[model samples]
Target: MVLEGLGKSLRDVLGRVNSSSVIDEDLIKDVARELQRALLQADVNVQLVLELTNRIQDRALHEEPPAGRSPKDHVNKIIYEELVGLLDNGEGLELKPQTIMMVGLYGQGKTTSTGKLANYFVKKGFTVGLIGADVYRPAALDQLKQLGEKVNAEVYGEPGEKDAAKIVKNGLSKLSGKKIIIIDTSGRHALEDDLIQELKDIAAVAKPQERILVLDSQVGQQAGPQAEAFHNAVGVTGVILTKMDGTAKGGGALSAVAKTKARIVFIGTGEHIRDLEPFDADRFISRLLGMGDLASLVQIAKEEIGEDEAFEKVAKNMLSGKFTLTDMYQQMQAMTKMGTLQKVMSMIPGMSKMEDKIDYDASQAKLSKYKVILDSMTVNEKDEPTLIKGKRIDRIAAGAGVTGHDVRELLKQYNQSKKMMGSIGKDRKMRKKMMKQMAGMDPNALQDME
Candidate 1:
């Protein structure tokens, strides 16, 4: 949700281009101005905004559309390419055995990010450990320990140790067998000399493979200077931007960090540990332009739903018109694992534009209640909801601690799904096309079926 306003503004500009009868010099200028305004409003540096918009304007006015591409498509492509170039550093974190040292000012979510980073690696089947060398902040080690517990990673720290270098040495000795070791260093209110020296000492002792600077998204245009200073002091190799879900000025932080030529390794999209995502310029810009990040969606689905056979089974059931309340319940659980409904919607092309029209909170609450109601049902009831009559409905409502009306509403939803699936099943051609689409066999062929 970071830079939501900027995304909307850019999408609006593209919408105007697609709606216009003509793509002319005037339209290009107008688009450039709109983009300039959006970036500036997002707290991006004025000079950088001008530079980018000028490039966009030049390409839009001078470049000819490809043989099959329309003028609008050509201009959109140019904008997308420029935006990608602006953010991408052409580098990524090496996923081999390495020690990562986190450096940043205080209150930048460094400790939390350490946990998220460790979790990310662990999910990739790597053994990870955390070294809490943050001796300045009270209870920092305890916080890291708690997060380590949550992520099922080992945490190393000496409670009364005043020397961070000594703590780092000891942690390394303790967690030497781990594939990835992350050292969480102390931070100050500003980039003070002592903090820099302490980081230097810890780095010397840990001999980390990557030195990452953790930045708060709210830092806005200051991100560039901060990154530069840190890079100059201790040679920062990568950056992590945190609190991206809450900040309107996320564009500023991203652009500023990009300007420093530091590769952004990851971004914290939400508070959940699973909310962290590896930064990919193409996917990030695709989502911003309402084109969806299908790769990320697929990855999350694969993680949540297990093997490919499970999805095939679901597709077969839907095509056979045999979907039950149990299937719906399982789907809801998978969706929850993927993320919030709104997040899932945003990853779907064209659905981001409809976010305002949907009551996400109410829908989420309804989903929670439905799950609880389903939990109260027996296997027979889940497979055959029609078996539940007045008395049975009352029993389920009591068990689920909901009104009878709520149970009826859930049944109504199930009936709708069943009816929809039945219709798809009856249309053999449509069912085949749908299955093909789900299998990612041929999307264009499915569109042709329409």
Candidate 2:
């Protein structure tokens, strides 16, 4: 969803401009101009915009899409492929037992990204280790330890060490049997020569397969110069664009790419560990021009959500019996991720008409009240909402700041939803159809609802 607005705007303009099926030169030119304007407006570099536009125009004019496909489809494909090519043309990084140095300014997310990348390697079935050479602050060591615990990666650091370079050297020596070692270094407020020298000394010991520079996305044009400075100092092999969930233009990233000519390896979309998206040039650009990108979403879900958790969810539904309130709550959380009812409904071809009746706001509001009621219940009450006799109901109701009837209302809604899911489980074809429909919603929907 990094390019959400850019994608939407391009889609809107294309949808409105052409009514014909023919792939005319004029229409293509118009689309290119509009797209260039859109990318440039998004804070993309002028040269990058021109380069993308040229590639899009050249291929779209000569390309022959599948028979009966809309001209828009071909254009979307060209945009996706070209952007992807621009983004990731280099051979992918070799995945081996070598070090990866994460560098960025203080507060630029080196500490978090180091762990996320290590988590990625761990999820891929690699034995990963972490060396937190950041001795600038004791809080940093704690931060790395907490993140390492979350990912279950071994973090090596000296809490009292004053010299960052010595910490890196000693930490790497202690860690054994790791296929991947990520060293998180101390950051500075700006590009200081002393800091650069310190990083070089650490790099000499680590011999990193990759030295990635993480940067904020809100700096607009300033990102180019910053990337250049870092590249010149310690040599950046790749860039990690962080904080992309906000409305930041992130044009600065484009500048950084131009300045360093380094590949973008990963992007941090949100605060969650699973919010990292491996850079994909093709599908991303395609989506920017209003074509949906499914590749990244599928990868994220498959990697982050364990197969066992998925199996549990699937197995419970197969029994065709009463689903407990616990199950209902889990489903509500999943739906919160999948998307709003109205948005999900819109993806279903015929259900577009039912959008007005979906009552998403009402449903979500009711869900909030349901959670409150659940929190106030005793252990016995949660297991059996029916066992909450009038006296217990009153106590629970007062505890949750709601009427006893509101508690009953929550149970009623949960029961109704459970029955619906149970019913859906009975119809394999319908469930499959609904799942497909849900997948077609925006990627954020998938993340939000699931």
Candidate 3:
């Protein structure tokens, strides 16, 4: 969700062009102007923004709607395709045995991205290895070692070796069994000659399958120059953008790197080791425009919850009007496993806009509090809440170490959820529709609700 403001602005512009709006020249012009403004505000290069908007405007005005597609849908599709073309490299990484050499300037998150990348491959069942070739940074090897341990990947490093090439050569020999070997090179404060030369020497020794340049999203317009310099020096085959969770200038970095003709292989969405995701421009633009990215949502769900049969039983119970505090607690636990509520919410279509209206941290804390309150309740109270009167409420509140108001809030939420389940259960038509929707969901999604 980097460049949130820009995403909001662009979405608003699209919202204005509803089905009722006529697809005339004036409407296209207005949309083009709004898009230009949003891109500029997001710190995209002026020339690039103009070029993109011009192409969008031309296509919107000239392209004919396909069969069964409305004019509005056609224009929107045009914009989506153009934006994807602007950012995507149109190729995916070959997830086979390969040696990747990571290079970047200091403070660009090169070291952290190395760990994240290693973890990503490990999750895909690759035998990954990390080589600490960054001898200039005193603690680089230690950091890599810790990350390798956390991800259960092997680490090979000569802590005292001053020659980066020698360390890379030795690490390669030691980690020959690894399916994916990542060499973390030392970075400079700036793009200096010595850093470039060092990278060249290491590349010569390692003969990396992919020379990736890690650029911080906040680098803005400078991303182009930096990528060019790296490509000139050691031949950057791909780029990895980091710190994209909330960067205002992420658009600039992405577009700039794309302009360099180096494919963007991955993006660091958050600081967590599991936050690294493969870059897919189409899905990214879809999420940005409030269309959602169900693939990513399913991927995260698969990683977190897997295929839990408990969820299937819960779904059946809910359909049969058997929901209780226990069910709610179990559901909340599953949600907690799927990372932050905001992140989970943004993956659903129409929920990205809701993230701004809700306080995610406060909401998460409330969920935990609700679980604790539920734990303090007796079985009778959890199943038949009407059995609890004022005195019982106070006792439950005291046991849960919460105030009476908090207990009442939980009860209110429980009552609401119960009513919803009861309505769905009683109406056979609604139950059928719900089942159909659940059946359409990906099997790998959080849990199979059916």
Question: Each candidate's root-mean-square deviation in Å?
Answer: 12.7, 13.6, 11.8
Q: Identify the candidate with maximal lDDT.
A: 1
- Superposed Cα RMSD, model 1: 12.7
lDDT of 2 by residue, 1-450 (tens): 455556566656556344447668988888789888877877777887898898889888987876754566566556656666666646445666778999888888899898898889888888778988787757988888988899989989887877777877777777767888999998888778877888888888788879999988766766777888888877899888898776666667766876788888887877877667776554345434432212222222222332224333633543456666665555555554544444333323223223443457666666676667778877776666668777887888899899988877676655544444545545433443344332222222333232
Model 1 worst lDDT run, 10 consecutive residues: 434-443
Clash pairs, candidate 1, are: none
Better of 1 and 3 by lDDT: 1
Give one digit per residue, the lDDT tens place, for model 3 in 259-376: 6778889888778897677786755676676543222233233333453444444555665677777776666665554435454454443333333545556656777788788889
lDDT of 1: 0.76
TM-score of each: 0.66, 0.61, 0.66
Off by over 4 Å in 3: 292-450
